[model samples]
Target: MKTNRSMIRTALAACGFGVVAMTGAHAADTISVVTFGGAYEAAAKKAWFEPFTAKTGDQFATESYDGGLAKLQAMEQAKNPTWDLIDLETNDAINACDEGLLEKFDKKTLGNTSDFLPGSISECAVAAMVWSTVYAYDTSKLKTAPTTIGDFFDLKKYPGKRGMRKSPKVAMEWALIADGVAPQDVYKTLATPAGVDRAFRKLDTIKPNIVWWEAGAQAPQLLADGAVVMTQAYNGRIDDAVHKDKKPFKVVWDAQVYDYEWWGVPAGAKHGDAARKFIVASTTPQAYADLSKYIAYAPPRKDAIPQIDKARLNDLPTAPANFKRPLQIDAAFWADNADAINKRFQNWLAQ
Candidate 1:
C-alpha cells in the first residue's frame, strides 16, 4: 500500500522534481488559509491548493470569513493567529498592510514581481486574479437591452427591482457613473463631499426598488429567482451562471469596477515558509492559466492570458472590447474613503 506522501515522493522522483525545502519545523505539517469561501475557494482548491499539497506533502486546511482586517487584527493582537494565507480584496489588502497586520513577501519567493500586472505586486500581497463588478440582466426578461451604467438606474425604461450589494463600494461608484460622471473621473469626483452626496442622491432614486444582496452568490440567485430584473454581480459569477446553467444573463461592462484579489500572509502566521512556498507554487503561469478553467476571473500575469480558453475571452474584463469603459477600482481612494462613506451609507439606508 502506497501512502499519499510516498506516492508524491515517487512521482517527484520520476519527474526529477526539486521541491523547495520548507522552514519552521513546528508549523511544517499544515497551513491554514482563509478566503471568502464559495466558488472562488472551490476554484482555488482545484487549481492550486490540491496541487500544492500533493507536491509539498504538506497538509492544507481552509477557513472562511467575510473580509475585514478586524479578525486578522484580533488574531495578531491576541498572539493566536489561525490563518497562514489570506485571499484579500485590494482595499482590504491595502488596509491590512498599512496597519502592519500582513507580512511582506520576499519578491524572490513569489517569483518575478515584474511578471505580475501593474499595481498587483504590492508590499504585502500579490494578486490572485483580475476581477470586476458588473451588473447583469436576464436576457429573456429584458424587453430592450441595457447597454450602459446609466440604464441600470432608468426605472421607467427597464422597470423592476434592481439587485445591489448592501455596501457602498461598487454601488456608489456606479451611481456616480450613472449620473454622467466619466469613468476616468469617477474616483476624483467621489473624493469630494459633494460627489458623495450626488452619488447618494442618485441611489435615492433606486432605493425603494433595490434588492440589496450581501454575498456574491446571492447576485445570480436574485436574477434567477426573478427577485431582481438586474443585479450588480462579480462578472465571473454572471459569466458562470450564463455558461454553466444556460442562463440568459447578459453582463453590462460599462463603468464596471474592476480590481484584483491578492494573496497575503498574516503578520504572525506560524507556517510562514510553507505559506510562501504555496503562494509561489500557486502563482506560476500554468496555475494562473488553469484557474480560468474553474472560474471566469482572469489571471493577473499577462503571459497567462493566452493560455486560457479562447471561447471565454470575450467574457473576461481584460478583453479589449469588454474593457472599453471599465473603471479600474482605485484602491487608495477606497482605503481613504470607505469608513466615512460607509457611515453615510448606513445613515442613508436608515432614512
Candidate 2:
C-alpha cells in the first residue's frame, strides 16, 4: 500500500496541538507510554514520541515492560492506572480488550481502517508494526546452511545446539510446520488433539539439543557466541545484527509466523487525551515510514510501504520474497488455547 506524501503532511499538520482534544481540558502535561525497550523504543521516540512532544509541548514519561497483563491487571484492580498508552502484541491486545482493560478506539481518529492490512486494527488497538519470529544461523559457524523450517529440526544433519525461546508459542507452530503440516493448516491441525500430539512428537526429537533463550537480544548473542548454531529470533534483531553489527548471520524466513504489535490506551488512564493524540501522530504514514527507516519492522498500513527505503525492503518480514511462504499468526487461536497448551508445554519441557 502506498500513501500520498501530501496526504501524510496534511494529516500531521491537522494533528498539531490536538493533545487537548481527546477528553477536553483535563489532559495531563505528561503521559506515560509503555513498550518493550531497545531498537523498537528508539525508533518510536524518533518517529512518534519526539515529534508529538515537539508539536504538543507534552512531556512523555516512558516505561518499559514485557508484554503481559500482570501489571495492567494490578493497576486495574487497584483502580490507580498510571500508564496512558501500551504497545501490545496482537494476542495481548485481544485479551486486554476482552478483559475490559483497554479503551476502545474511534476508527475515524486513526485514519481509515481499510488503509491498514486486514486484521491489524481492532476495537481497542491499532497496529504499530508487523514483525516475525524467524530462525537465523551464524554463517561463519555453519558448514552447511539450513534452507527450510524443517532444517531447524534436523538435529542429525545440523549436529549442534539449537537456540529456541523457552516459550511454546512460535516453537509449537514451527514444530508442526517442520513435521510437514502446511502453514495454512497449522492452527486447524493444532486444534485437534491428535495434531497437538503430533506437534509435540516432532518437538521431542530435538529437545535434548535445544538451548533455550528468553529474551529477543539473546538469540543473536547466542549465535554470535556459538552458544547455539541457530536460534528462533525476531527478524528485526537478526537484521540489525547483520546490517549494523556485520555479524555473519543469515535469516531463514521460510515458515515464519508474522504478527502485529499494536498501540492501545489502557482503560482509565489518567492522560487519555494525550495518549489518543500520540496514537494519532504515531500511526500517520510519515511516522510509520520513519520507524521503518530506524528498524526492520513492517508498517501495518499498505500506504506506508511506498515511503520506506527500497534497499531495506528485503529485510522486512512483509517483503514479497520472504512473505511468499509466510505464516500469519492467528492471535485469536493463541488467546483461546495458550493457557492449555502452555501448561502442556511446561510439562513436556520438564520431561
Candidate 3:
C-alpha cells in the first residue's frame, strides 16, 4: 500500500495502527529472537518486527544464528538467561528441545499452527523459514555438467573444482546422497557405522578438489571467482549471486535437501510468553511472503505461497518439482549424534 520503501513502516494513528504506538496497559516486554542474515532477516524486521513493536509496545532484539546459540548457552549456564526466543535450523532446534532448555509454547502465544506443514511445527518450536541446498554450477566451467549430489563425487566425469559447506549437516547428507542412498533414507543410513563411513568415503573422493565454504555467503563468492565449478549452496545465495554478480549459474533442485528453521522459546525466560506472541505476530502469511523477497527461501507458513505469483513462487524450496527429489533432514538423529558425528566429520576433513 505504501510506495515509499523507507516510509513503509511508519507508525499511524486512529483508523490505522502504527508500529509500537498501540494503546493499553500492556507490559513493555523485551523480546529477543535469534535468526540468520540476508532477506529473511530483512523481511522479519519489516513485516513482523517493526509492526509488532508498534502494535504491542514490545521491544524486539534479534541476533544471528551462531552468535545467538553461544549467547543462549552462556545465558542459561549463568542461570540468568537473557534471550526470550531463538531461531535455529533443524539440528540446533532439536538439540535445544532434547536438552530441556526450551519451554512448551501453547497456541495462544504463537497463534494458529494449523497452516504450517505437519512436520515443520513442533511442541516447543515453530517453523520460521524454509529453504534448501542444491547442486549449483557456473555454466562457463561445466564441461560434462552435474545434475545431483551424486555428480559431485564423479570428479573424473565432471572433473573441475567443487565447493561445499564445511558444516556437518550439508557435508554428511551430501556424502550419503551422492553415495546412492536415496533422499528418503539419508538420515536412516547416517545412523549406522557403515552409513557414516560410506558418507566420508564418498566425501574423500572430492576432498582434494574441494573448496570449503565456511559461511553461507561464501558459496556465491566461490562461484563468482570460479573457485569451484559446482557447489552445494543455499538456493538463495546462488540466486542472489547470479542476479547481482551476473555470474552464469543454474540451480538443479533435483536431489536437493530441504532445510528448515524454527523459533524456540528459552526455558526460564523472564518474558517468554510475550516472546511467543511476538513470533506469531511477525510470522503471519503476509510477513512470510515479504520475507521471501529478501531471502529467496520459502516461509514456514504454508499459506504464504499464494502471496507470490506462479512464476516467482515456483522458485521456493517446497515447490512441487523441488520436493519431488527432496531430502528431509533427520532432526532426531542429528540431536542424538551431533557430538559424535561432528567430531568424526571434523577428523575426516583433516584427512
Report how far off residue 325 is in candidate 1 (Å).
0.5
TM-score of 3: 0.85
Q: Which candidate ranks first by TM-score, i.e. highest?
A: 1
| Candidate 1: count of backbone clashes, pairs at least 3 residues apart or interchain | 0
Can you write out model 2's per-residue Cα lDDT over 320-344, one digit (the tens) per residue?
8898788988899989998899899
User: What is the alpha-carbon lDDT of model 3 when measured against the actual structure?
Assistant: 0.75
- Candidate 1's C-alpha runs over 4 A off are 1-28
Candidate 3 lDDT over 1-351, as tens digits, reads 455633644534444754544432256877877666554566567767777777777877776554225666777788887778877778777777767778776755546768877777777787878878787987877765567667777877887788887777768887887778887888888889999888888877888998887666777778888888788788977776766667788888877877777878888988887887776775788877876765567887778888866776777787777777887777778777888988987888786
> Which segments of model 2 are wrong by more than 4 Å?
1-28
Residue 12 CA displacement from its true place in model 2, Å: 20
Tens digits of lDDT, candidate 1, 13-86: 67756434322222346889998776778889999988877766778798877677888999989989888999
Q: What is the C-alpha lDDT of each candidate?
A: 0.87, 0.87, 0.75
Candidate 1 vs 3: which has more TM-score = 1
Q: How far in Å is the alpha carbon of 326 misplaced in model 1?
A: 0.7
Candidate 3, after superposition: displacement of residue 227 in Å? 2.2
